[model samples]
Target: MNLPNQLTEREPIDPKLAVGSSLPNPKGLLAIVLALYLVNEEKDHLDYSDKSGNTIILKPSLITSLKAFFNGITGYNATEIDSLASANPLVEMQIEPLQVPLQLFWKIAKINILGTDSSSGERTGGVRFPKELFFTTNMDILKNVISNENGDITNTGKELIYSWLTNNNTPTSSVNIEQKLTKTLSVFSEETLFKTWNNSTEIIFQQEGIYNAFDTTNATVDIGGTKEIKGTLRNLKSSISKDIHPYLKISSSNVELKNPSLATQFDNYQKRVSNYLDLNPKSIEIKIVETEEEINVDDVTILNKIYYGAPGTGKSHKVNELLKGKEERTERVTFHPEYDYASFIGGFKPITEVDAESGKEEIKYKFVPQTFTNIYVDAWNNKDNEYYLVIEEINRGNCAEIFGDIFQLLDRNSDYSITPSNELKQYLVKELTSVDGIKGIENGKMKLPSNLNILATMNTSDQSLFPMDSAFKRRWDWEYIPINYEKSEENPSSHYQVVVSDSISFSWLEFIEKVNTIIKENPNLGMDKCIGNYFIKAKDNSITLEEFINKAIFYLWNDVFKDEDDHIFEENTFYEDFFPIATKGKEKVLKILEKIGLNTPEKED
Candidate 1:
């Protein structure tokens, strides 16, 4: 069977909680996040309206603003970001404060803005933070909200935070942020402090933001080692003042403990707290490692996701790593209604055997191993590892009939089921001649061994076939394979160097785009035949190129039209209002064929 080339093949992946694939597009992200929330809330309709009556659908403006905010704080603490909402909350959630590492997100936003030049007053490196974050300004109102009726900017900076949110909807420009200030600056009106003020660093209220709430206690600190062995960490409230407390860090190796100058106090406090609490050390690797037997279904290469897709795709190349030229150990079977249990499972056969009474060879019943029985029984007796059964053109036969009772055995999820009652029981009990080259088991049923995998190839292009049954379809994971054509190394500018190659190179995306435009301009064409599967059987480079040319000619003629011997290579028969039929009329077909610049030269191969 000819298999088309596939464009992408993901490396073997472990099926743990790998970060989910990125949403297809930005809009898809919004939809998925919304869908998750709505599902969680059990709401029949989504609540698009904000606390205010205004709807807040994902908009280009909002997305742009968000991107800016993320880029602004490129280097910040990760633990500081624990409050952000996520698609899966429980997985990323951390109950303890020390477990929060603040450095993770700092790098993300930093990367976004690195080397980027900004047009607006935003993107300034200083803490003033990309100005896009402060797009909305009702600062005074917010101050007033947290402080009941207190309009004084100097006295009410902290108190007015609560009232601002209650009075209006969630402020659009980076409104939701909550963190106890490690260091605060005083706020003052010109009239209040010095009475006459040009801007000065002098403060009206010296106590503002000057408080540290959590203090340090005891620690288990090391003198010098990269790996932190043991440590004590604590979040203590200062007896003198709540804001003056420190966070302690502890470790067996003090080398890793070295950091920014201000880290000394927090580090010492963390060391004390960890030992006092008998806590685990810092820096835990987060990769989820799974045991072999408990391996996730994704991680296990069942080899079932056969690369079947749009034409020109590379399905065979994907298996090149395993099947380049090596002899195959897999059992390949073609299913047809004519296939019987005798060919699938072991069957009782009458053969000549020596009988002592007759002193001559006599017919006796013996079991003959079938394809399914061979591989399965081999693994049962000898654990020589993996066994495979690849069925090509899987749907060509009545699968349910040909497969009979074995479909359930091959199912991905079915581990154990009662022995199928019918002509299969005795055959299922039959043993194979070779068990991975070892002797076989006499009474074992034909069980699908743990390491056995099944690969079935199907072509959706086939018009005649029963729709794949639900029981059969539900178990297989589907992967859409795309085309990846082999490009030639010839140069066209110099005819001498331009060695003509078969199947001219074309970008799938570009081709699809062109087709879309043609469909829009001329509605009469049916997409089904518009070169849906454009593959050429290349006997050699020359023959291959000819086959490609013929395919193009047929596609141009038959796809956008019907039979048209009279069609010119440059005529226009398409009408503005006429929708294209599956097969175009002779005249229109000829016109389109000519329009598309197609021709087929007779070739002797």
Candidate 2:
């Protein structure tokens, strides 16, 4: 057999003649049986490395057949070969008994199946079979069989073995080999064969003859002969009982079962101890630790939420603050008046590409994913982590038109799904088929993963631009962001001062409080048109004369008090009067501040 380049070779085995009744390890016996079948068929070699780095050479065809056999028993379609092979930790534990059987095959059966080196010691390892030992139907039967954790053959193993032996065409010469295998299979039984084999091993025989004492009726089995140990059985039973029933009382010397029906289970536990002693034959310690629960994404009651407030009230800032450290897990999009479903979700976009074979520039239209699709796929692929899809200025665009049929997914009470278009379905199927928990993506329907959260911001002032209907509005949990007027660290804008000149300045928060009171009193201009504390940001804690007139004065004149008869501005005063170039621009702004009950300080000398 020629091993693959990734495998490492081990030292040559020292060939020894057959001694007493040393049975082959169950997993190793299964490997050799499969190897014999493949050798008869002249298949190419397959190589695998044990945990100790020793290379085990077999046939590549074994992977496909073994995968099918395992899938039949497990009832799951295992796509990767490694999932069924020893590379998986669980599978490795199941088939680890191959170690002792390899040595036994060489010693007892005179098989040189273990790899060897060339004359120059180049380590060219391969499998060599004797001419007399050819493959048979019995070999195929043993290849597909499975064994229990105790190394005993299962019912499936027994059925396969019986079918192999009952065949009429079985050669008479093969009966001798099959009989030897039957004897080897008996060695896995804990009751009769193990006790007989235990007598030959010196170390196991001396352990108070405990193997013989293990019966269903026995209340106590001695571990230490003539030695009084403190809490020995209590500690031993405590560790093993975690796997067994808890209906047992632990004394200093013995573990007494509360019920008589548990005797068989206790007897099996004793057999496991005997098996461990037979393998170890030396002093060993065992310790058990409790494993911690796995971490998962935090649950939220509101899956879809929208923060609504006036402009410059930190609605977007609140969303960003909640997702402060998790920038990588979040996808952000800003909605506009022209925003459509294709732009928010996904659509086919034209791409200019150069053909590799023809060497010509070609234009192709491909389905391209936008913010929604990008975050949706990411959330499904990584279900253990939380993902965010943040939409800024959500009310600026038509909600019903932009969300389209995807609005059905907002109700996460159940696994709400929507059938995507043909283009999106094909793209999603290609990306999501390999992932485990994600379903319906391969079929045309799609749902948001539980870990995905959609958060949006809406300005109450712009809510009338593309008014959302009651159906769409009720789907989202609405939160209102109120303006803070108190001067504090969080409300930095409260300390800002609007400067009309060197001496003529007033507190920005005080000005907002007075103007907001008037705006609230008016029926047309309510809280929606009220000036926000942070409507205009200040430079170095001071709102310059130019900044104040450009932002605050502009908004109030045009938006808030544009058509109101009871306005703050002087009679017939145009918006251009707030400009510096105007003759009475500065004087007009001062009179309006005083009228709004804001203090206008005298100019400095």
Candidate 3:
């Protein structure tokens, strides 16, 4: 139950080695050294003098062995290799023997890049130790054994071991092991570590894993000899930082709480650390002003903001502008009528898996994650960066059905924290508990981190498609993008002329203004039916007759006026100008314009 001394102790071992011994030698010797280090006892320090006449010098220390092993295997200097291992947020220190060594080997098989045969492309039947033992690196031993002859160690047993370590594939400088080690460390984040731990379900440090088991200040040794969390959080922090087991098994009944509860508390502490890493403001203070006034602050924290406007009103454009210049994680998804909980969050899906015993393939259902689950986990990991999830056309889908139990996550207290339902709590714990380097879960609940912002864009016209209840709307701060026909004029480079046949060429800006005004003034055609200037953008500053007819005209006919009576347009000109191809030209369009008294030829000049 005691936290390992490795978590709380570091010794300065000033290692001195023989001159001219730093150059790259064969990897076989390095593997033997590493194998010896992994299988050594607590007091045992590796020494090259034990192997008679061997000039290589290795000091026994985790950091020293890691440095020498990496330097020798990949020709990188010890300093550079040391940095590579330390760069990861989580560093797995002790390789404990819980199950049999062979079973443990298979447990880490996915992460093990070693132990392959090269020339024949097969697994080498190396030495397989029968029993599970601490500090042992599981692998087949070399067939060649070094013999002590004439007071000197002879034979290439170390070289054979190195070949076994690298799966018999001698790594060249072009395809070296250093790059593979770097990649493994880079991809090895906290979440993945927790996932591996959860998968392994084995203790990282046993009672005898380290020295000075009883000598600790941050934690207390209970009667049953298990270490318990003291009032302070220093021990938990140290344990997690060194990748020591968070909760140790205890036999004492005097402990204030059980190991499971202590683990949960430790997890919550990790979540706060994750929050602090992102530099996001943890608190938000809102003051109600007595009068109408604008308040500006040097620091802004936008948690959940939604934009609503008519179609083509530049809602998405505004979102991009808001996120500009920020080094953040951003994901976008659109909600439609068919969008469901399984697609938004995650749900079980059927897949085929080979049965280990039967050696036959069988169908099984596993939880497949979608957009929300991915962003949720990412937000926890990259806490130092802002994470934005943009939901475009949120109102188009049934929000009630999509959020399901997760709807409760939207209800933040004054402190901007959320308490999840029991169902959601169980689900989150089950799915995310073992994720390495992840933090911020508490009592089976989580709050949307201050850095994780949910931005949604809703077309006001599509309100009828899926009505968002008052409860849902209340959770989000809404920003309205007003319809402005002259918006194109704000950026003259985007302005264009709409042409229909030979005699009809007019400014698209003026056409939109005129059409929108008519639609607004007509009681039957309300504001919802009014056109936004960006509905049909000009191609090369000139909108062709065909382009305008297909995009703008089609939308007006099908989306806007479909519910309106035909008499809304003067002399049924709307239908005639767009109906028959023979009459759907400049002459017919001009006649309709004249009928509506909108034909202003001088406007183009």
Which one is best on TM-score? 2
Each model's number of backbone clashes?
Answer: 60, 1, 14
Highest-scoring model, lDDT: 2
Tell me, what's the RMSD of every candidate? 26.7, 22.0, 19.9
Per-residue alpha-carbon lDDT of candidate 2 for residues 264-383, written as tens digits (9 for 90 to 100): 765675566577657745321111111111111121223699988877777777677555534667899999989999998899999899999999999999999988988787667654
Query: What's the distance in Å from true for residue 460, model 2?
Result: 0.7
Give the alpha carbon lDDT tens digit for every residue of 1-605 in model 3.
Answer: 99656665643110110000111121322243334444342222233211112111222364565544444443334554344232211111111111111111112111111232111111111111111112222222111123234422122333333343443543353233333322222112121111001221322222222211333342443322222211112222222232223333332322222244565664454454455534632122222111112111102234677888777767787677555423235678999989999899877789899999999999997776778876776666543334678899999999999987666667543434456544444556665532321343555456665446788998776788989889888988887777654444455423677766555577776766667776777687667766665677667778776676677667776777667764234444554466554355445555545544566564222
Error of 1 at 73 (Å): 68
lDDT of each: 0.33, 0.55, 0.46
Q: Which stretches of model 1 miss by more than 4 angstroms?
A: 1-300, 320-328, 336-342, 346-366, 421-447, 485-534, 539-594, 597-605
Off by over 4 Å in 2: 1-302, 433-437, 440-442, 581-584
TM-score against truth, every candidate: 0.37, 0.52, 0.48
